[model samples]
Target: MLIAQVTDPHIKAEGRLAYRTVDTAANLARCVNHLLGLKRRPDCVLMTGDLTDFGRVEEYRLLRRLLAPLDVPTYVVPGNHDEREGFRRAFSDHGYLPREGDIRYAIDDYPLRMIALDTTVPGEPGGIMSDERLEWLDAKLRERPDTPTLLFMHHPPIVTGIEHMDVQNCANASAFGDLLERHRQVFQILCGHVHRPIQTLWRGVSVAIAPSASHYVALDLDPNPRREFYLEPPSVYLHYWNEGSLVTHLSFVGSFEGPYPFFDEQGNLID
Candidate 1:
């Protein structure tokens, strides 16, 4: 199965631009088009978080419209920027999402089981793995111990060198890691809040953070780095499950010269 992961579109309403610069809606539209134009279309799309800039109803409405072009099933979790109640209301049609409380659920329709975690704090920029949320995940993992499972959330549990981003990363990461020690079925954790593509191993499980489709957090590793973003080349993460393992590919958005033959018409290597 092929899964397309698009994160942090940060859609704004009334034709507004994110950070007074990036045209998030347009970028997301292009990203959506990119996904549709992929040679091997994904079976589903996982939108990790930050679907809107302010989590307002209008923003969610616009976000829904922007994502309407994607024909494949799409799943989403809330990020710090997303208001829980508004987010739930926006995606009410998605029956997988609960009507109240944390927006967490499990999907078993495909070969790879997926469990979505809600890490958003009500009015904060940081994330947390509270006892309630962790308990829910533990119970879900227990139900299918042998099945290969994928966990999708907004905040990554690992600490990247970017100090600013790290501070707002998922809190109680060690506790979460300890939880993973028991659930061997969880092969991967897909996340998005960092606004940059990152991969690492936590508790023997693979964790991948997909870059934003709108803007990217600048790659700064200083102890007191500036909290800034750039309109980088937008992209999406394509996860392909092949032969018992999942492989992820970073597919950049926008048009570029390509398909040039590397070999001559006679099939000889071009010199």
Candidate 2:
């Protein structure tokens, strides 16, 4: 099964640009087109978070229009930039999303069970896994202990070397780590808050952060680095589940060089 992970699109309202510079809408359109153009299309799309820049109704409306091109099932969780109420209202038609409360749910239809965790803290940049949310997650993990599971959320619980982004990572991650240690079925945690592609191991589970579809947070590791972003090449993470394991690939969006063969038609090395 192929699952395309697209995160932090940060779509804005019509005629608006994110941070007064990035054309998030156009970037996302290109991303959607890239996904559709993949030779082996994704079975589902997991939009980790930051679906909109301001989480406003108009932003959500435009986000929907941009993502409408994707025919596969797309699941989303709220990010720090997303307003829960606005997000709920925007995707109310999606039956998988709960009508009220935090945006959290589980999908068992695929070979790999997907558990989406809501780590967003209202009015705050950082995220947390409250006791209630932890308990709910524990219960969900227990329900399918034998299934290989993947947790998708907006905030990464690990600290990246980038100090600015690390400060806004998942708070109370120690407890969350303990919870995951108990659930051996969870093989991976997919996230998207850092705006850069990163991967690490926490609590014995592989955690990957997909890069933004627009601007990427600058990769500065200084003690007092300023919060900055760059108009880098947008990309997505394609997780392919095969032979009972998940292999992820970073697929950059936009046109590039040709797929030249390494060998000639006669199966000889090309000079």
Alpha carbon lDDT of each predicted model: 0.93, 0.94
Candidate 2 lowest-lDDT run of ten: 164-173
Candidate 1 backbone clash number: 0
TM-score of each: 0.99, 0.98
Question: What is the alpha-carbon lDDT of model 2 when measured against the actual structure?
Answer: 0.94
Candidate 1 accuracy as lDDT: 0.93
True-structure RMSD, every candidate: 0.7, 0.9
Question: What is candidate 2's CA lDDT for residue 83?
Answer: 97
Off by over 4 Å in 2: none
lDDT tens per residue, model 1, 1-271: 9999999999999679888899999999999999998889999999999999999999999999988989999999999999999999999999899988899999999999999999999889999998888999999999999999999999999998999999999998888999999999999999999999999988999999999998999999999999999878999999999878999999889888887998998999999
Q: Clashing residue pairs, candidate 2?
A: none
Instruction: Choose the strongest candidate by lDDT.
Output: 2
